[model samples]
Target: MEFSSRARQRHLRLAGDRREPYPHSLQFYQEPPTESISLAEFESFAALAEDDYDARRKDHISHFILRLAYCQSEELRRWFLQQEMDLFRYRFHELTDSLRQKFLDHVNLSFEAVSALLSGFVLRRVCLMLFKIVGLSDAVDLFRARRVFIKDGFAFVPLKDIDAIVLNNYRKNLSKALALTARSLPSIQSDERLQPLLNHLSHSYVGPDYSVQKNTGKISLEHIDALSVKSFPLCMRQLHKALRENHHLRHGGRMQYGLFLKGIGLTLEQALEFWKKEFIKGKVDADKFDKGYAYSIRHNYGKEGKRTDYTPYSCMKIIMSNPPSQGDYHGCPFRHSDPELLKQKLQSYKVPPSGVTQVRHNLFGALFNEALFLNFISY
Candidate 1:
């Protein structure tokens, strides 16, 4: 009855009306099969061995179905392509050794001899396909740099060079695609049947929940000076340094850093005293501090007004939201600080230039990876 009706709707949504044969050919690629497949059937097939008869049939068919849904937007298409590439890699890995060799030979991938020693051979191949727009100048540069082979004015980028180029291209496309997706999300989400899946696909967790107060009362104000030097995140460390040096923090800085201190176990009384002493050293008198700022500190600790126990900002939250203005020491250093200034700051802290570069690279990679994971759950 109701269940059957719902099932039928789902089938139609996934498999199409089934009146015409599902066109297996997608734009730009003609590798998929010509058969039609329902969403449920595609899922089952994708989960089976590649050698399975039905799985082979459905593999090619399922891609076209996904293409139909994903072709609505560039973001969706890129995500779909990446996911299909991942699936292809997995399936390729699962093939027999002989079959693997045969597949490589069929693809005319001579570099397989070099890449077999390294993992991600399949991924490298897929990424190469995604990043085929390498310009002639760039190809010539890569050739001159001995990083790629050039034949007949075409540069064949090596496996080692693939990651950087692929990641850069992915970043550019993904950023634009995300902006486009956000603009178009309202229309895309209008369909009740598609909204849940679309929302799920877009949802991503940046890191662990900072709202959970597992470390409450674990830190003491007496040790904060020492802890700030050693255990604090870069953002918090910068705030602490600014506070110690200037003896005053702007409202934004106070809120951002105070909440973090509260999360790390600064009592309401300790926080008040800390801020009071720091402010008094500057232009603010003790009386002004009590009148203007004490309530806010208390409020942050759930002792005033709404008594809401606000959580500390997570790294993602700090990075993505409410960026600090000029004269503010709060906000993510990675996001807020000027790059050259940040490098100088890091060097002043005794980090070597190479280490600074590595840190920057790692942070960028993490941010990009998180963005990719959240924006496209299928990948």
Candidate 2:
């Protein structure tokens, strides 16, 4: 079964849209595929034999198949470009060392023996091209952050830096192409079958569902304290700590953290006891706890209201929705916390500055991008 499943996935990847070949020219620009392809693709393509027509055709056709779905919206286009770049990088890495060097030469980016002065001169020209292609804002951000260095008013960019530039260029052209495609989508939507398939593909999950859990009853209330210290995600850990220290949590915090505790295997009775004990120790007396908070706790456990077994919040959910208001510690710190406070919190947690920077970059680059993309699609 596993073998068959793998074979099916491989087949789908290589032979996308097997029903009929797209009759129209779907190429985004007049440039030949070799020149128009991303830098990563250029490297991988260079490694292939000249007569490998079947492999080349497969690569060409796959792009158009994706374009069909991805051209539906700006968000989908961005996602498709990222996925293609990732695929290109994987294939490029698989090339032999000699082939990789040869690819550099073929792309006119043989950086190893170039003098620093020459490299800087080349990079300034490349940066100009990038600014024209990707616009000033994105070009500046991409170059300033990675794989480029500046000295004495000129910039030096390695071959690796060219990958980012090429990807950005491809993305810009693709965005324009998608706009053209979108103009034609109304006519294409007349096809009842293709319409649904295109819609499904556009909204499909591109990454793992982080909310999934194989075992729901693995943890017990007795061990939650130790687990929060050692195993909880940062958001949950902070919520746990806040609850412990204050002996109470606001409604937002309680809903967010209570669901988490329930998902980790707290029985309804145990959860009620836990919240009641903590709340009574603070502002809420036993009567107030029973009157106001108990129902919500039971509601989260699926015993009241709609009886929905509400899942614990995923990272994306925490980052993108119902951000913590003042005094609330429930939402994503990366999205909601002040930068200086976030820095101090990370330092207090003994995270190195570099690690903190990396965490911030990953959150902003991946999570925030996804959130924005989702918003684009939904709105």
Candidate 3:
């Protein structure tokens, strides 16, 4: 995105209180850009200079470029899919009734309003396009809810619900397109120029890294146990409990918990001492613990091998990663644990029985405040 000279003429410019300009487009959307956007955007918006590249062509080309870049991994694919779907939903809702029809026509999705089905009560609305004829099984929710009229083996969706049908169709097509793109990776990866760019796109982190903790090493070992009660996140609390009770965690648990602790403030020396003491208290003596476990903790802090400092896994990463196995305590409880098991864990934590409804649909997105999350679940 570019701005014209008139942007400086605007009273409120596109810049944050931090005096920072909005970054590239993806980061621009990922973070709140009110401070940085309005000024620069309006400035750019005002100056439709002759030299400016074609905005429509840029938007179209940019999406295809991203498709190639983001189709490399499951995480990237899902992220792209979600962003595109959200954009579609927003744009669709913004369209006027006539504009919406035009867009549908533009996309070659011919949808006729089913208001013509009945006479007198409602009639004569139907026209050029036919209603999206979906299999009875495909529109089961609409069928069950009695939202759409069924004829023979097809479901006739009304104009209001046609967007949902069209949206699903786009999702399926886009997903298949991504899959087909992925299949071409062998040839694509050999293109030295594109490979590096695609690799970067797949692994890009949008916001602040939890690295360079301001309070690093300020947190003492003794305080960790206290922190677990209410301060630690749900998964971290569970991992801490398991580590203490068993005096050992399998590789997955250790990686997850160890990085989290490092992110919080545990320094290299403290981390080594913390693990050594705990492991010795169990079956592993000091020597065995040093041999088996010491390297991993150091590696996490960028001490060994290639020594690339690793960031702690985000909640999203943990959610997307492999499901934890039995005797493993790495994954999010709301996500990985059985429903009954999750409820029991909440009960064990003394969460009110009445507040356990959030577990019903395995929804964890709204789980910021534990008490309120439980309350929401009950709803």
Candidate 4:
């Protein structure tokens, strides 16, 4: 997330600002650009022309700023990696053949050109002699596009499709570096000034602030069950399900789901009843709820405590922070916990249990595809 200084400044705010090529230094530099670039300048320079040093500097500095901010967690690292790969592929594709070769040389990414890609039939004797190994074509984007030709276990990757090699290499290196950076993050976190700034950037919300709700008190409590199934996002639908079945949500779930209900026009009086009615079903009585959970629900509407009326959490905020712990049913459905939890949930969804055991790497994905998410909306 961008800081206040960059609140209005989109790195790619310019209509033409979509290129991914940034300076690749052998070392990660600690000294960022001393001067600040305005939003107008940023838009003008978003192209990062090689001849223009200042434009390049803006791109380079912003890259480091985000790295420091996003290097805190596995989820953040994955998100950053995906974004970087997207930009990397974009910039690479925009290059001319000569420019592409120059970039390959500059980045020192050595792609083994196969006989199909070469001008003549010349096979590297060394690769031929070795045991048949897979190419860097394992990268999902390239594999999906059929850019990689595999015969007898060897991936014959063409020059036009060399992006797979580059991205695969970059992904490995960046993932390792992010992990290392996270390990050394405690030192950075020790700096009180820097810690909050990093936290803010990592959890930054860039879209419209949903804090303002003109349609408050419009949604009736009776309609929530149907509404959750019909219109709520996957994260909220899961929260709704958990709240109803378990009759309780932890602090994290309450904050995330409660703010959403408030934002969607549930009034203060309705909010109190909604939570109280649900909470009383399992553990708390009506009187206990009024004394306990009611204040917290009102607090979300700026009625108590700090009286800070919080907005509904943006999708980014939900993805980046407060990952659900054991017995918690809030957060990305696909990113939920151990095999036991997965098994229980999969069974609840009526997904075949056999598929869960078969999915070794991405257990949640194979079963919970488009249909499952559609169920969240269609139900």
Candidate 5:
């Protein structure tokens, strides 16, 4: 039987309810539809179309990314470079050796494959999206985007090896490295006032199902807002506000905020102007702006900053690859997970234990998002 509206309200209260045994009920879980193509398939497809990929690859994938995102700002470019350097210095080595090796290999392979498979028009569009994923405003920005890409590439090596031992070895090594990093980082035991928000923000996008559900209209913005209220951490709250209010956020959050702003309706010119002025606020000079910011926009937008590119709008790669850490806040959640850790974190946030297990189990199944639950119960 369909759950009554009252029953739904009661279940939701469980988020805050701490009574013994906590209430249990069968509620409709609304799942979102996923894109049909797999990452392997997408990569292979791009590899097959190498000639096209190269032409675009040469034209600068970072610019394409920024232009798409509507974030090709003079100010944004400087900040991006600065952040890349900062992250590279502080967090690169935290990655596992095996994972790192895998990343280097995959990048070489992926590059060669794409070069061989795609070029020209086909490459341009595909790169447009990939550039965005790496947090570049455009294809030209990739040289700087390299650090982030390298870091994430290792984090997301698709286990295609037929050997179980090799695959298991890869998994264990990566997990230990990530857990070690998480443990070593200073715990954010800030005031309780920030705890609820911090926990929410930290956990918010952990599930693609959340985004999918909203896009498919199975869940309303109200529900999303509610989820955000609990899972939205201070970092994300600031991010959400920056994107929604059109303010430029500094440090590592700019690329994310910039892309999100584009998602909500900011324009390229507007976004650029906003970021340029923001960088200047931190004492950057006009000369730096011209060489760095202006250059990125022109190179990425393809018309000397006069045109808007669609790079910033592409979120799939970033969302599917990087997840947040002490320094890697530019990534998305659906892509990164530490199996046991993901479960514990979800449960702590009041997600039904069953839901947590279900999500973890379905992470690698053929289908993703809503398609996994077509005709299923509505959350």
Candidate 6:
């Protein structure tokens, strides 16, 4: 049986709708001026700028450039920055000294990228032409903080590079998955009114985590597992495909992405609304959705921005890499890749499984409880 078959069955039983394909150009969207800064230059400048990067005030210039550079709108950047700041404050201290130093080193790269954007390095453009210049993976690398989460044996990259790949992957797979969605959930209605919402959920919303955390706190095991199962729809189908086929992550990687998305504001109501729209009959009873899926998304998204909304860092990577424990949700591959272990997991994924370490290993890298989380969020 194909992995999607299992996932599909699980999804259907869990009340997922096979959504219609999103009608969108599969092109990378980016502004031009933001693309001018070279990775080397961005890193060099970020190293110098972090010391000067002010935390108290919004660096409008830096913020603006990043908005353009990443080809995201300013509103998106503001929300992202707010999320990142909140995450960093919670997980910063939990990071090992080595990870902290490494993060600080690359954080400068992020600063430089932002600075370049603020300074008008990129100009507006039709295609994300700048992606070719820097590569999509490199962009995500510039801001990803997962490397700081684990203790050893992995490679790390800057967040700028990481975003590039993640965004591109999302763009590519989202369309493909949407195209196949109708077939996937054939029981659903062709004229479903909710198709647009499904398209939005499947296509527009999912991407990589570039935020950092400032401290670490107790992560509940039950919460971790619940979010793990709940993450499928909120995460892109392609990512879901990658994790299940990849094996090792029946746990780790799946949980990580799930929790991370929860931490970032993808909510249960939104998720349910998304799924129901894709149903074949254009009908998903509210009571059924409530009984089966709604509660988990609520638990995952957490109480309307209160600190109660929590997901563990351990489970997030399942969407990014193989599970650390084959089927358990306790570790991150990017941060915890033991060479021998990685080989086994890779083998399971049919990914050579040999000395195959560090396919953007550094892409790896969160934290805290509610009352304390509130303090962090307020800051």
Please, what is the whole-model Cα lDDT of each candidate in the order they appear?
0.59, 0.61, 0.67, 0.65, 0.37, 0.35
Distance from true location, Cα of 143 in model 3, Å: 5.4
lDDT of 5 by residue, 145-220 (tens): 3422333232211122112222333334433433443343344334444234433332233333322212222333
* Candidate 5 deviant stretches above 4 angstroms: 1-252, 266-306, 311-315, 319-325, 348-350, 365-379
| Model 6 deviation from native, Cα RMSD in Å | 25.4
Instruction: Name the candidate that leads on lDDT.
Output: 3
- Candidate 1 structure quality by residue, lDDT tens digits, 65-102: 44445555665555555554434433444456566445
User: Candidate 4 or 6, higher lDDT?
Assistant: 4
Model 3 vs. true fold: TM: 0.54
Judge candidate 6 at residue 253 and give its lDDT. Answer: 41
Query: For model 3, where is the 10-residue window of minimal lDDT?
Result: 22-31
Screening candidate 4 with a backbone cut-off below 3 angstroms (N, C-alpha, C), the clashing residue pairs are none
TM-score each candidate.
0.54, 0.51, 0.54, 0.54, 0.28, 0.23
Model 5 has an lDDT value of 0.37
Task: Compose the digit string of candidate 6's lDDT tens values, residues 115-230.
Answer: 23324343344123222223324444443644311112222333433333334343444334333432434343343543343333222312333344322333433343344333
* Comparing 5 and 6 on lDDT, the stronger one: 5
lDDT of 5 at 241: 45
**Each candidate's clash count:** 0, 0, 3, 0, 54, 74
Winner of 1 and 6 under TM-score: 1
Candidate 5 to truth, TM: 0.28
- Candidate 3 off by > 4 Å: 1-59, 73-79, 86-102, 120-149, 158-163, 183-191, 212-214, 222-250, 272-379
CA deviation > 4 Å runs, candidate 6: 1-239, 242-255, 263-270, 273-289, 304-307, 311-326, 334-341, 344-379
Per-candidate RMSD vs. true structure?
Answer: 12.2, 11.7, 11.0, 11.6, 25.6, 25.4
